[model samples]
Target: MSSVPITKHGAGLLKEELQRLKTKERPAVINAIAEARAHGDLSENADYDAAKERQGFIEGRIADLEGKLGAALIIDPTTLDADGRVVFAATVDLEDLESGEKVTYQIVGTDEADIKHAKVSVTSPIARAIIGKAAGDVVEVQAPSGGREYEILEVRYV
Candidate 1:
């Protein structure tokens, strides 16, 4: 499998979730299953069935997170020296050519992409168009609403 690019913060969050799942959720589900089993008849035990289902979900999530962590290529934005060009993990400040609206976005991994936080995936249209561009360059993005133009105002490594 190809390496999955992830920001340092995203990798830390994944690791923390993996730890919580293994140490807390896994053990709690096991205990719940055991207690439900001790309640007697297994045929009409709704609690046992529910606990088992929850255990399945938790185990599945743990496996998924582990796989992602194993394949992750954590990159610290601060360590990169791309000069003024936009790159993965770079925070870019942009101004809309039409509306004059200014916004900032950090190009991150797909798993960490959150528009509410101004973090965009590296594979996103805007990111793809802006990558390798320097400040003062104008980029055209293929948005769902049609083509949009943005001027790169600044590039930040943090």
Candidate 2:
């Protein structure tokens, strides 16, 4: 399997989730299933069914996190030396050409993309348009709303 690129922070978050699922969620679900089984007929027990379903979801999530972490190529944004160009994990400031609004975004892996937190996936249109470009460069993004133009104002590793 190919290695997936992930920011160091993103990898850490995934690791924490994996640990929680294994140590807390998995054991809790197991106990719930056992307690439900003790209550009586597994064929008609709603508690048993719900516990089993929850167990499946937890196990699936654990496997998915493990696979992703095993193949992750974690990159620390602070250690990057991309000559001021926007790259994975680089936080960038931009000015909207039409609206004249300024915004900041950190380009990150798909799993870490949270617009509410100002993080964008590397594959996103805005990130794609800005990657490899430096400050003062204008790039047009094909957004769902319409094509939007943005001028790169600054790029920071942190």
Our model 1 lands, by Cα RMSD against the true structure, at 0.8
**lDDT of each residue in 1-158, candidate 1, tens digit only:** 88999999999999999999999999999999999999999889999999999999999999999999999999999999998899899999999999999999999999999999999999999999999999999999998889999999999999
Worst 10 residues of 2 by lDDT: 37-46
Clashes of each: 0, 0
What are the Cα lDDT values of the candidates?
0.97, 0.96
lDDT of 1 at 88: 93
Candidate 2 residues 1-158, lDDT tens each?
Answer: 99888999999999999999999999999999999999988999999999999999999999999999999999999999999999999999999999999999999999999999999999999999999999999999999999999999999998
The 10-residue segment of model 1 with minimum total lDDT is 79-88
Query: Per-candidate RMSD vs. true structure?
Result: 0.8, 0.6
Which residue pairs does candidate 1 place in steric collision?
none
- After TM-score superposition, the amount by which residue 120's alpha carbon in candidate 2 deviates from its true location, in angstroms, is 0.3
